[model samples]
Target: MCAASAFVGYSYYENQLLADTTTHLLEHYNSNYVIQNLQGTVVNTWVSWNLIQGQTLHVSIVNDANLPEDKITAIKDAILSNGTITVDDSLLHEGPQGTSSTRYKGWEGALANLQSLPTKFYIPQSFAISEGSNGAGDVVITLTNDENPDGLSGYTKSISDGNQILKSKITIYQSSQLSAMQLGAITRHEFGHALGLAHSTDPSDLMHATIRTDYPYISGCDIDAIKGLYSGDERSQVMCQ
Candidate 1:
């Protein structure tokens, strides 16, 4: 009887410790992730595919812009790559150091402490290109020479139900003027939006508002932000710093 009572007490203590740790980690995440709106209201605007829809994001390329085979392939490849998210441990450690800013030492430290916490988080998704859009996919990419009213090279619009994304459309403008490499970069940036990523504060990152980076590939910060979004955390934007 005494042994059983001791065991029960230990269990309660362990559970409480876990809860406290999780709370701290969440606080840390919010400090770095959450944003405030113009009305001074805390808004967590990040949205992404729910578990069901994200299992497989079927994509259909309309190719209406009549891009060449190479450009078409580049666009397809870019979509596929961004769909696969892999967090870089190096990046987690590269951010601002010291615990003065937060209780945790750094992103790596926070993630390490969070590893034991049980939470519903996003898993990496797979992307498949459906042939001719035989009603197989919810994402549509249209390549067109039609210039955007905003004069942007690419644009993406996503429809979401609540915080869950339902479908997305990507429009690439002035495709004729873009080289295959340029098309690939633009496709990557737009596809990031289709996958529910907001623009990064870092201009050097691929998800920036403008595609000016010489290497317009997905960055570690982008992956980390997506992971946070799919985890159901509402963050308006994510920054590498």
Candidate 2:
């Protein structure tokens, strides 16, 4: 009788532990932005902010000190139109020692990267470019020689109104050192962040945490992520009306 009683007690203890573990898992799953397939299986995870369609956003360019106006214009042109800007590497002025390179990416390259995404959003000449101005822009692309000890290429900051993006700021570091292709890649990546995309685990993806030096571009998974974000499905937290 004592042996049977001990077996029943052990079973009860195991069941309690299983119940606790399940509860914890459910809480964790519920708190994050989880991506699932039609089969009701989790595929990936990331957080995003929705951008309402037909809302125009203005982007301003703030150049580094002593930078030429034409150089700033090149960046501005790239962001405004899906066109290429011929970069004369020989004409680029020198920057800090061991911190500058002759390569620069064109604006079309970045636009191409964004265009590759299978999203329904359009990029008209909605963004405006500017020089040093006190007025605030919906999105600011600041070029700076800030201390980049970690060798980061670019960074982006954004504000969202719980459901949609209100504004965003993209900072490009060592802009002179980057080749046109690299600049385009970085721009595309930062723009993805501004559009409420999180990093992808795949190294080849444009939204990966680390930008690949070799012509890194967007992937089908990245496209699917954006489509899912705007799909208005149950997995999405923000939906467009």
Cα RMSD to the true fold for all candidates: 23.6, 20.0
Native-to-model Cα distance after best TM-score fit, residue 222 in candidate 2, in Å: 3.3
After superposition, candidate 1 runs with Cα above 4 Å error: 1-44, 81-121, 131-136
Candidate 2 local lDDT, 1-241, one digit each (tens): 9999999999999999977854432222111122333444544433344445434556666766445656565455445544333323233322334442222233233334554344444432144566665537776777776745654667776655443455667777766644444455666667666555666655434566776424344334444555566543323222211
Which candidate gets the maximum TM-score versus the true structure? 1
lDDT tens digits, residues 1-241, model 1? 9999999999999999977854432222110112233444544566676655336567898876777788887777676542333334334344444411122111222233334444355433566785463433667887788967656677776666666666777777767767676777777777767767778777656777765554466665776776677566777365786
Candidate 1 total steric clashes: 1
lDDT of 1 at 124: 32
The candidate that achieves the highest lDDT relative to the unseen native structure: 1
Model 2 misplaced regions, further than 4 Å? 1-53, 69-74, 81-126, 218-220, 233-241
